[model samples]
Target chain A: MTLGLLVEEAGLFSTVQDLGRQGFQSLGVPPSGALDPVALRLANLVVGNPPGCAGLEMCRLGATLRVTVPSLRVALAGAPPTGDLPVLRSLTLREGEVLRIGRVAGGAAYLAVEGGFDLKPVLGSLSTYARALIGGFEGRRLEPGDVLPLLRHTASSRRERALPHPLPAERDRPLRVVLGPQADHFTEEAFDALLGEGFTVTAEADRIGLRLSGPRLAHAGPPEIASDGNATGAVQVPGSGQPIVLLPDRHTVGGYPKIATVITADLARLGQSLPGTVLRFEAVAPEQARIALRRQEAEIAALAARLHET
Target chain B: MCAQPAAPPALLHDPPRLLLLGDAALTVEFAAAWSPEAAARVRRLAARVAVLAAAEEGIREYVPTLRSVTIHVDPSRLSLRRLQAMLRDLPEGAEATAGEATEWCLPVRYGGEQGPDLPEIASTLGMAEDEVAELHTAGHYEAAAVGGYPGFAYLTGVDGRLALPRRASPRLSVPEGSVAVANGFTGVYPATAPGGWHLLGRTPVPLFAPDRPGRPALVMPGDTVRFRAISPEEFEGLWSAFRDGRADPVTACRAP
Candidate 1:
């Protein structure tokens, strides 16, 4: 039987996202995906879906969805609701029940449903790239009156559950980075300026990237490099001296000189950082970055194992 | 001059310099200069890398640009050092084979509402609007790289005389399929996007159609592009045919 949900009131911005659209960078396709992948995986797992299942990623004020199916199971992660509602826990809604998500405490949140979204993967992913007008539901942000198809699910005994481990709390620690493919392009003073001072996330931040306002970094030589591939969390400094932390929706290639790359483990924290939040950068060894990433992965696996045990 | 013989591959005299683009990707740059020889060398290296990627585990994808190839990898499955070592072992100056690239003839409607900057561009270059269009149509351009926007090909090989710098203030939105020129390169905007390039014309054919099967982009890196001017009436006719699925924006041509 077919199942679905109707968006009652679309909030600030909501789009369906999965792990990413992979293997298409050569064609200049951006890997548009969930900004907070950890939260997305967790939310999906809570709903008994695979980690890469497509889910709704909401920013700021979240959307209100009405269950059109006989019943629907869902889980929320990342930003908690400002209201008394408990999140990061699995919950079920009856037919005609409305799920209201309030303004995000942080920057974004992920809502995953049981059996995942019933959508065809574009270029092997359901992630939405609004700029290119591809992927997701109708290749655009969710709005009122939009109906989303849901993968049919069989009723299960375990309808509700809570995460064994609490979601990671937002910390004020410095964002760790691994210094560069183009570190030599800048003077030592530039490095000092980059790491020594603080940067405020500008209002221009979005799924594409975060523009930071901080002390201007001085280039020792020409600022332009032969255009090269850009990575998620690549800290690129253009001629303006302001750094841009690229995200999932960033262009595949860029000409700006990248001074550092934020470690994989810290990307979730970066994703949660709201505009006006001050951030500091800390340089770490490549080995340290890898170890941190492995640790996070291990934690995720452990969480999944724990959930299965329950 | 609309169709020229494919450039002979240049022998890689100097070893490519490799730089780590974070832990997940590495860039192999052949030369800093933008020249046919440099582009040829980069393409050859990219081909070699593609073979390695297919044979080896952990390599995700590779993007070939004007003078370099960037290979993305899974760090957990493959170490940066090991991947670098594998690349170092590849044979240097491998003779590149010929007749592998495809040539595409794209139809464009010049001047009028489609291209508002045509007169300004022509006057600035001391040439008539038709002369500007003719010069643009004459050059056989190569797809240097496809980026900046989805399916937007950074084409090279615009005639030196028709080369123009980007506008001081970029247009808020350039219409999709607008044929533009800037800094010795000619390209077609795959979608409506903000751009600074001087628009000379617009093509009814979509450069990028995600809905199309097989290849979503009409042109990829290393493909040759030739523009043929069409009358406004013909433009409308071809556009309708394309919309109705009777005509394709791209057709295959054997490399000469």
Candidate 2:
């Protein structure tokens, strides 16, 4: 088989992504990529692909893929939709084999192939930002009957490698944030509400942002600021007072005053949080946040280390 | 690509403040309001940062806006602490490249179906249609920021008299190349999308083209932009020229 999988069913909000499209935000292109980047990395490593290889990012619902390539190494990570496709385990799917990935337990899941996709990079990225219809598998999500170009075929080996799930135990902890590039624009009461309250993720969540319904974050004035570069995970409190945690697909520049920004270490944890899930925020110093990020990186590196033992 | 240290640049009254935006990004904030002074600093900082990011592999990307520039880096390659220290040491006299900008004079056909809200805009401001167009052409605009969509530059420096608020209800589809004004800014909707601005006209030239050879954004932030009113014939000719790939808009519109 020349191509990878023949999609029998296209899941809700499924797209081909890598880390993200980079160095293009100045041109107003939002960097769209895998919601759970850590999962994509782990899935890639387990499948013997580069940690930042392109893979399918499925949210909530998962697609049913029929293997088209003669033989390819595959693995699912980050809240695998179905028990059949266990998290962090690699499997070799041959031609005519059907893999049914059902519903995700959390916000999103990733399915990685050994050599990644044969799709071209746009502006130096394999990530798909469908709004502009740029990059990755025709610059859009996969559809039924769409032939996904698989880059390389792996020799069929019976050795299936796996790693223990690492994020589950820390899932319930509050997501850490670094207080602002615009914290002074918000009121003290706003900070109290943001730190003390548990915000429930609303149905309006997407790769763009997670709309949170929590205590209102009152602004010092009308929620206005000179449009500035928006950092990923910036908790922007607009006139509605609802805090929308900006995600990978967020606009590069924003006019609203940002209250606080979630640390990079907690972004994957935040990504896995599904709608109706209550999440709390904790502000940490940048130094502590760096330490947390380093720890998370260590965890992934260690996971990669255990891959050989499996 | 290094920072030039001739002298401190003008138009900036306060020293830029460096603020952390999580563990990966550090925003260099120039000002809090939308003013020409802040816009100049934003443009100057973007020029320097682009040079620095290219020279240093550690810095990942940087997004420039009207008031700030957010620099992203992999913490492993460049820690936030190192980035902060580097910026603190960067001499702020990079405005030497300020005058080296190309002014794009885009052609637009004003009024009629070409600009549905032009009549309303003129009436709202108590001016005649030609008077409105004249005032619009009289002012200079700079691409202070590019957002909302790819190549959609947030053009600042609209004439104060022509300033108007956006519509309460946005139009479902603002035709591509639609030039509009709202809240003291003039922006051209690069791609047809939901928009709330007051339509002034539609430009024949495109702002964002994927196949653009040199840069992604045609009217990049810090570039100057000027609008020229054209007849229906001129509009039709330029529009088709751009659409059918007869004339390259970038080469045609860029002032020598």
Interface RMSD of each: 1.4, 1.3
Task: Score each candidate by Cα lDDT.
Answer: 0.84, 0.84
DockQ for all candidate structures vs. native? 0.56, 0.68
Q: Point out the worst 10-residue segment of candidate 1 chain A by lDDT.
A: A152-161
Model 2 chain A is weakest, by summed lDDT over 10 consecutive residues, at A151-160
CAPRI tier for the interface of model 2? medium
Estimate, for each residue in B170-210, the C-alpha lDDT of model 1 and write its tens digit. Answer: 99999998999887788999999899999999988878878
lDDT of 2 by residue, A1-310 (tens): 4477888898888889999988888889988888889989989878878888999998898988988778888899887675566778888888889888988888888999888888888888888888777888777888888778788765346587888664554767999998987888888999999999899999999889999998999998878876788878888988999989999889888888888999888888888878999999999998898788888888878767777535
lDDT (10s digit) by residue, model 2, range B1-256: 9988655445444678887888888888877766777776777777787667767788989888777788998876788899877776777764335445678888889888888888888888889998898888877888888886889988888888877877999999999999999888998888889989999888888778766777667898778888889998998898898889899888899865
Model 2 per-residue lDDT at A231: 75
| Residue A270 accuracy (lDDT) in model 1 | 87
What is the model-wide C-alpha lDDT for candidate 2?
0.84
Residue-wise C-alpha lDDT for candidate 1, range A1-310, written one tens digit per residue: 3458899988888999998888889889988889888999999888888899999999887899988888888889888878766666788788888989979888888999889888888888899999898899989999899989988643356747767764565467899888887888899999999999999999989999999999998888888876878888899999999999998899998888899988778888888878898989999887787787788888888877777322
